[model samples]
Target chain A: MPKLDNYRVPLKGPVHLADYDPAATPFAHGTVKAQEKDLKMLNKQLAQLMRPLQGENKRSVLLVLQGMDTSGKDGTVRGVFKTTGPQGLRMATFKSPSKEELSHDYLWRCHAVAPAKGEIGIWNRSHYEDVLVPLVNRWITPQIAKQRYAQINDFERLLAENGTTVLKCMLHISKDEQRVRLQERIDVPEKRWKFSLDDLTVRKQWEAYQQAYEDLLEATSTTHAPWYVVPADNKLHRNLMVNTLLNHCLLDMQPQYPVDYPELVGLQVE
Target chain B: MPKLDNYRVPLKGPVHLADYDPAATPFAHGTVKAQEKDLKMLNKQLAQLMRPLQGENKRSVLLVLQGMDTSGKDGTVRGVFKTTGPQGLRMATFKSPSKEELSHDYLWRCHAVAPAKGEIGIWNRSHYEDVLVPLVNRWITPQIAKQRYAQINDFERLLAENGTTVLKCMLHISKDEQRVRLQERIDVPEKRWKFSLDDLTVRKQWEAYQQAYEDLLEATSTTHAPWYVVPADNKLHRNLMVNTLLNHCLLDMQPQYPVDYPELVGLQVE
Candidate 1:
């Protein structure tokens, strides 16, 4: 297995999307059957580890997933969390901002829902959307985007200092792979409703989105809250990699069941 | 099986807490082993039913639980949802109002967190707490409490009008049962942390609190949002009754997998 650090964006340098291979299966080189087995094992460990985290109840987790449409953000959530099954997980998916949301600063909405202590909070799409959408579409000045980056870094730093493990994964998928998935949405009756015309519009701006993602990945990948580019072209491999990263981070935290209460020794129920 | 309607508070007339038998197991008179098996089946059914409700994306469920401390409100949430496992469920637990919360009206905090569309929201305790605590302790005048009841009814009516299925349950535990449970919390080392000294202070006013619950159950039990008093002394029976009511409500709503897209017949994934 490769060092997971091999995927973390460098803190001090510009990033190029071309450097990462979206098709690489460094984390899962096994046959499809073997990969499925491995993913099942990781998922079980994640579910078990959550007991101690919520039992300890002092710290929590925030997983932020940002990716282009048809890039499997929703799929990643279901696949990665299927075994864990929301034991202490709270997922918030940010759609286009409502009128009330737009009236506030972008982070205001994000800050409001930060996981309460002891929860594993998942953001299917998050604040990074602000940086990407506006920057690509020129809705915000570059200077404002830069300011927002610094603000995001500061906010994450506070969460880290106060016991939050922030993990951000940008589901990396090749545009060709996206075309296949987008068409699948259009083709499957059960999935057809998920297809939207706006998705095609977003696909048309693919290069601009790639540039925007590269820019933000460089600007916001701080020491406290790093960005990981997950190779998400293959559905099974994407689930495996995300679950692997999640398991490693949770095990590293090493949350424990609380110590036994000495004062209640030999006490009996009435 | 006994009639589930046996527990529903009548839409008109006063509610007498003493009339309900907290120790009764009308719905689950089977052996403990059999009751556990039934609950497991119900839990699986709840998990299965969540899919079509989420896929429909039009309506949602809001379940409110109110009960005395150690009456198993937390236990009910854990036992009932242990299988559902939070796929699209959102759990919001209301504790004492924080400084910011006190500034707004009582329902403001609750209204903000009411279940989103296609989500089954579980409230460990809810705006109903406002009626119970303040009215029991005389923090609010009788006139104020009466007015708040109307406000609550209107708020719930609005939610029902907007496609939310609201079900409220009051975990009815005898004072003797509560005493045993509270003492166990005090005695068991693993459960010692859950024992709050303030709970005893509240216990001293049990009769008053019961009266408060009775008053609110009468005022707020409407056509749209009805309250059911669960006989909660037997934990298994409590779980069974609550699950039965929930399954019935969900089945009645009858959310179906959407079948709207007609444009993509015979299309194939590239």
Candidate 2:
């Protein structure tokens, strides 16, 4: 078993997807039932940890999730935060940029929903998608992609300095795993609603997407906000690892609960 | 029984809040249980009506909700949309604008989330707030408010012409009812999370908000997208009225599935 930091993209070198195994479950050390129990405990701890963040009302946290389709971004949200509840957290899903959003810089819409003081703002898919999708499809040049990486780092550093802890995660899943999930979505009556003809189109560009992800993970991994590649071929293990990483970040934040209001320390209310 | 159009703000002349009784249950007849039964039926019908809109994939619907503090915008959404489910509906709640959002023209953020083709988009306190809040708080001049009215009309008309059905409802609740709801938030321990001290400051400006609403309603109620004032003091009646209005809009849309595609008429999947 490796430490959590082992998954963090190295800050000083090139990134290679081959270095990380998508089927590995290095974070979980037990059977499926034992891992589920560990996840239940982690969710409870996270819910409690979020309270002081809300009470202090001065700092915030943002968890960014980026992955290919069927990589379980939505599932991770539901599974990890079932106990943290909605009030303490916000889930912002950045789909294709809208006409008005396109009228501004790429980060305009993302900044508009930055977690206010005292909330855990989670992005199911985030600003990273802007870079990945365009870069993979040849809609943007390598020079432009490089420029975006610098811009993203600066934007994130600004948030970090001004009361936010930005954590980014790339749900790393195997191509074979995605095929099974896509097939289930097509074959199962309940899940068939999600079967889109477009999914197949994107799947054809799998290797290009993997290259794009490797590029972004290398370029944007900064000290202020680093990226983590979570091996997410196993759904349960993905939830456990992501939740554990999130809980670790929250503990590190250690938001304060103000205990200094002395004006009416002993005054009685009528 | 008053017809649906009876509650629509007339397309001409000055408006008066005095004309409507906020506590009246004119839209709901019979027992509480009976109204509950009717709502359940309407929810199912609303669900069925929304599917065709999705299948046609040619048009969309936008439902805008605006009201003063504690006037039940959230409640109406939960009640009316309980059965429409989440698949076809996109609820965009517009809170106080951020610095980035404020930099854009008022309608920029609203337009960014305008429902895609074949979806029912709901705005819980929408761009209408831009007009109402600023006008009441004296953040904008009368001339500017009048200018905004024209701008909003033009914006909405564009959406209508571009295949979006715009339905606006102002959750009309009496000041006394607002006080009751606010008090419950303060008095109940569970709801204390919702008791914002700022709400008291806003409550002090009740009459000003009503005037703002009346002004905007009169100025922007065009034939393309009219404003409906729902008597929202009674929780049940508010749900019934909103559900009925929404159901009516979907029925009027008359979206259909083209079940005769010659390209696939005889195609078979092995």
Candidate 3:
């Protein structure tokens, strides 16, 4: 099956987000089926690539997925990563750092959870928290923390230089979109536990966070580790775009089997 | 394919483990095509049963497996958990507590990582550290630490009473068998990183640790949250036993689809 070049949207800049309205985005994309089929096919190819890489243990992939609460980070993980062989996949979801993490550098906590060689580590929320939450809370002076942006770029560049393929996604959603989601959580008895007042406070500072995110993206979007600002107004679109990026990244890695292992020739099933 | 009746091995207290070696229990179950076929069949049944239960979201399963270093924790996870659906399954591995964790109550750190409803959480090593490590290091009195075993049981009972099914495993390997495996690690450059001088130090206290573990298993294993003692002499046996126990747990849960969700009957794909 041919890959869908036409469906691939050009990388949008920060300015393009002006038209963003999560609720306004139509989820009934005409190409949903085709796109999903492509994702499945791409995932199969990725599985084939991943098998040999497990034995080689040379490179590690860090998949950093950052998004607003209820913007489908968990769903994206479920859909895209469901097929990757379990052995080499490591997932680290960062919660609030512990007291020890506060004593040292912010990156210290993240450093401990980085994926090992021949592994794929999913960071549900990662070092980006240093920028996002601290910036939102005014915990650090803008100038001092601005240095962290470069530090992060260097850190990611170091990872890439030392054989890590970093795929970062920012799941973007509008304020109105978040309100609807928050309401869904409140209204749906099953989802009540997921709702929190802090979600509303975060939604209130949406624009400030957006500008902070935009600057962070502009500063750190290296050729080695590009950040995809995913439009997450439409959950379907968010899922699709994230899957596309993941499929693309895995395909780019082109993982191959170690040559030393004995090749299966005529081994028969008993 | 039919279900294999549970393979029961009779092992009584403190058998002079130094006499028995891995060679004595070399995986003699050769060419297991039929067994493999039955396993696959059982896995499909288990997955089918688990699919809908995720939506019901009434209960979660916590699988905690611990053993001496190189006792096949990762291998068991790989073998037994291969077929679980990604949506409802999560895994958390606890290494030595970071400096931050040391300051807090031991259970506090663990609480942050517990599985949500309708999920199966796998803890590679867990809160048992409060019991095991502290006791090993003489950081706490055995009397105080023995209280922890009761605390753990009650904690699990709380989780079980409120919709969590906890299944814990202790992989039992003889000292002679472990020495052979440790030797393999030292001889093979690839596995050398896994071996450490600390492992030998721990080996010296193996009997004390074994007694500690026996007390732990005896006190904590209950009907709601039973402990599965797996023989780790043979990797294949360990893997198969783990797979069977997991199969049984998922079967017992009998997860069904939430009745609230609309049925997929005549929906158009295109």
Candidate 4:
């Protein structure tokens, strides 16, 4: 319902800490707790719609979730989809391609896990990594990596053409906020296992990754597959935004119930 | 642990409902209260595992859930994995295949959504439907279809060998108990959605399906792929049994803090 295109993050290339504004925007008011409650109700209704789709045996959905570290993607999945009937959902999280996967094309591993008709397939972090991580870490040369970006666009486009409703989300969190979370993990005894120094190394390159993300969103947020930039500084807001976006998608799709079972005629006990 | 082999449903095919004494194992002692408490704890821990795995640029998991219509499969996933970190855990329920999938091998649709590494993949009903459903209904001739029983065994064997950790559970509820639940669904206002008049038609063939399940389990449960018959008559016991089984699996897998992080150096941050 909101302007999906207007939510892009600005880029001055790479900004120093002095250029960072900790208070800027600070996640929009009323998007957090207020939307969360609404999202839960919407999800219950949405579940009913998604349920019979599986039974129809004809169509399915592909939900792609992308976000920064500690952006609460997991929480969103738990809170929003916690009530959906499991019969119609399939989730896949792509990491670095395995030794076997790397032996093939980047999209090969992704192809192996696409959802079937009458199902919902989810990607936690998908082939976008083929662009985002390599660009941020200089793992690939720019010229070839740019080509990879185009390949990704075409790949997602093909999936969409074939009936996969692509819902891509970018969970946007500020650098300082991520630092706050990383430190909290270090400080809390129960959460200590979650901490590692490598987290800080990623934090150091935060601005560059943000720019890369901004660029990725601009290039790939096409009519068929648009990116929804969820203001994720507040975990609650991130979940609400995600729920709102997905609720919108399901409404738009308006998936219907399967035909009643002819096999059940006069079968009920009076 | 409990003798793994002895814990299973007996091999000669399921004994008649009247034969087994419910009072002999009414519920594992304290398993009920422990379930209420353990579910909260399990949900929290699973949430933690899901957070980073969702963001990690590597492996995903596919979880398959299957049970009788009201065998508490949906409720178990909702309660136990309620707080499951959303990023990596995806639920997919299988029904009849599409024209495209029915045109191919039965495994075609299932392979399309198998979980990638490091993610928890859930299946509500998997390819095992070929063995269970078809075998019960005489939908396919027993000669060709009974062969599929062995094929499914090998297919699951391949999955577990490939790190999928295939866990198959049969929610064993008694016939009288199921009738009571079916009646409750019809009589209760809130539970009306859960009842399908069609289910009574299926219930008429329950004894046949039970025999099919028993025969299938006997022929299929291998060392790599074992089946857990969680006494599901009691909902709390079912949840606790599932949690214990899964917790044991994760702890055994020993997913760890990466050893290479330079942060492990002597800062004494804690």
Best candidate, lDDT: 1
Per-residue CA lDDT of candidate 3, range A145-234, in tens?
Answer: 689988998898888999989988877777676777777766665555555567767877888787777677766677777776677877
lDDT score of residue A217 within candidate 3: 73
Q: Indicate whether candidate 2 or candidate 3 has the larger lDDT.
A: 2
User: Residues A96-202, candidate 2, lDDT per residue (tens digit)?
Assistant: 89899999999999998888888788898998988988988899999999999899999999999998899998999999999888877665544544456677779
Number of clashing pairs, model 3?
A: 5
What DockQ number belongs to candidate 4? 0.20
Better of 3 and 4 by DockQ: 4
lDDT of each: 0.86, 0.83, 0.68, 0.66
Model 2: how far residue B109 lies from native, Å:
5.9
> Please, what are the lDDT tens digits per residue for candidate 1 over residues B79-169?
7876564557888888999999999999999998899888999888999889788888889998999999999999999999999999999
Question: In lDDT terms, how accurate is model 3?
Answer: 0.68
lDDT of 3 by residue, B118-205 (tens): 7778888899867987787788887988788778878888888988888887777877778778777665545554555677778888
- Pick the winner on DockQ between candidates 1 and 4: 1
DockQ for each candidate? 0.25, 0.07, 0.09, 0.20
Q: After superposition, how far is residue B94 of candidate 4 from its true place, in Å?
A: 5.6
- Tens digit of lDDT per residue, candidate 4, span A1-270? 454444533322422223323333333346545655666676777677676565555666777788777766655666667767344566676756889988999899898788888777778788888888888998887786778868887988898898888778777667667777776766554455556577677777877887777677766776667676677776665665566666667777776554444543343332
Lowest-scoring 10 consecutive residues by lDDT in candidate 4 chain A?
Answer: A9-18
Which portions of model 3 show Cα errors greater than 4 Å? A1-16, A19-35, A261-270, B1-244, B247-270
- Ranking according to TM-score, highest score first: 1, 4, 2, 3
Q: Tell me what fraction of the real C-alpha contacts between chains A and B each candidate also makes.
A: 0.14, 0.00, 0.06, 0.16
Best by TM-score: 1
